[model samples]
Target: PEHFLITLALPAETEVVWVEDFYRGIGDCLDMFGGFLAGGETSGVPSGSAAVISIAATGSVQREHLILRSTARAGDALFVTGTLGGSIHGKHLDFTPRVEAAGWLVRNFKPSAMMDLSDGLGKDLPRLAKASGCGFSIDETAIPVTTGSTVAEAIGDGEDFELLFCLEESRADGLLQAWPFADLPLTRIGRMEEDGKEQALGGGWEHFRS
Candidate 1:
């Protein structure tokens, strides 16, 4: 209670690190906050031989980038884990992260790679491409923007709280057909290919460069 009160007195964007030793006894914390325990099965199936939860939190309003650009591949289909935009209106903080959904995808579909979308597509999509060693071509019309947000806001506005990922081209159709609305609205914005560098077809947002 004291720590909670202290935290309250700190600031709304304060970062708290509850566990310094990830291997110590953070299982309970992970379990409570969308984390699956290692050595235990997730979604009723064992996760090979190596599985564990790790986290790092700090005090500061920092932009988090999950899923990487190095793991994507040519002919891979791109996907967003949940609905896009409107985070400013309240959904970003209240909505659940797509950790479980990502676990399911890794275990079931075995995607080439995955990442959560924190910053808007403008920031994230490029990261995905950079991580996967490939470039992407996004169809602006197919992007899933929030109801009240404009296309630019949906693409550039941070705090959408979604996951943008890529899977083999072959599984794109099946993935959409199998789980249309698994948690948030999913969309096939584009496909991955070898383009030498990352560049958006329409345009994307940039923190330092635009």
Candidate 2:
């Protein structure tokens, strides 16, 4: 619910009107994020059956301001907001969505490409590269791992819920200087390469087993 709220802000004047869910926490989360609960349905499963819950949300965004994954280009700088890794330890539920930051970026810096890091950097970076038709080279030393979190975990643990974006290399310094959130750590992890090859020093969660 929180993530969806953040995504709605990418385009100008975006607002979430309603959310539907089978999870008990949905109402609380929607309320916390200032979204209307609208309505939803829930059902009980048979004995010994695994419980399943699903959430659906709807919102509107301005067409002119909409950001797309394929908008990245070579020579763009790659950035991630906030720390990563070990989210399962506590940060996952506690972390706040970067709605304001994302809106600021869209309105001011206008990143070439942007996405939220639901999957770990190692996995999602490659996907972003593929989407943009470019390659990326990230610095392992620059990745912001959370306290007590290993670099490997930062690369693969997922659930970071931070924003990952690419912007022209020239505008990076100005964006950093103008960043409003003093507490949030924005790190430049790497750059887009022309080769379109995908490479990462770390690994991330893979849902299916080989």
Candidate 3:
């Protein structure tokens, strides 16, 4: 009983061979996480229009096991997998998603909240906290920075493709010992709080601000 997935992509105005290559890449990426490429609609733009590719995906998970950012309870321990930051140095395009690791945790820890760190921790963590009606404090010093990456970069550079989750504090020690991936580090960075000052949180995304 796998949580089957269907993904689709449509690339426009490309040769048949190139389209095949794109589909192959998309299939491979989805296959890495027990998913299949289904299909996508195509819309070709006029000449001199910017190149565009559209993709969509759907997945199914049991209602009881579904993890969400808006459900972390105060005092739950926060964690993130793998080192963060410096993805722009090349890791972003080549990073591995923590799909397997997430499944493992679901089968074991039953986290209170979870989400992928697509945006930087600085941006995403606050979102999770806000949605949960709680506040958070992360130790910037404990952020697992990639080699040659600064703590600031780890806080804001993003593209880590890691698992950010919360678990009951009582089970935290067991998690530390029972984690199976020695190659991938699981870091306990912070925790949720009931009465924390939310004013310190900032998104740090520079591109678009309103």
Candidate 4:
């Protein structure tokens, strides 16, 4: 619920209709996100097997408001919202998404590319660069490392759930100055380099490795 909220910036009052197997505190979790359990299914699994739950959601937005990662271009400045790393220490489950910040950005400046940092900056940044047909040069020192998190962890610790985006370099300062989320920390991390030769970073969660 929280992840989708930040991803889409849907209204808090919006309800999430879903279906799922029975689980303790399920209703409570939905309530926390201002969602109501519209309908669901319940069943018992084999005694020793783990139960699985699946949820589906829907939201609406005007066509003009859509943003995509492929729009990034050379000379665009990269920025990240909120701290990174050590998400395993409660940040992943508790941190709020940058929905409001993203809205403000779209309203004030046109971002060339945008995405959430779920699979770690190291892994995700390359994907964004590829989609945009550009390379990226990031300043390690400018990355916002969370307390108790090393720079490496900030690069690789998956589930940070912050926003990473690129915008025109000329508008970077004005956007930063007009940013409305006083509580959310925003940092300029890098720029889009030339296409075809990407400077990639190491570390990130891999679902499968030998």
For candidate 2, the lDDT comes to: 0.79
lDDT of 4 by residue, 4-81 (tens): 221122233333442222223455556554554555444545555543555655555467777888889988999999
Query: Which ten-residue region of model 1 has the weakest summed lDDT?
Result: 1-10
Give the runs in model 3 whose Cα sits over 4 Å from its true position: 1-17, 199-203, 206-210
Alpha carbon lDDT of each predicted model:
0.64, 0.79, 0.79, 0.78
lDDT of 3 by residue, 124-198 (tens): 888888889988878877879999988888888877778888888999889999999989999999888885655
All candidates: TM-score:
0.65, 0.83, 0.85, 0.80
Residues 117-195, model 2: lDDT tens digits: 8888988888888889999888888999999999899998999989999999999999989998999999999999886
lDDT of 4 at 79: 94
Would you list the rank order by TM-score, best first? 3, 2, 4, 1
Poorest lDDT segment (10 consecutive residues) of candidate 4:
1-10
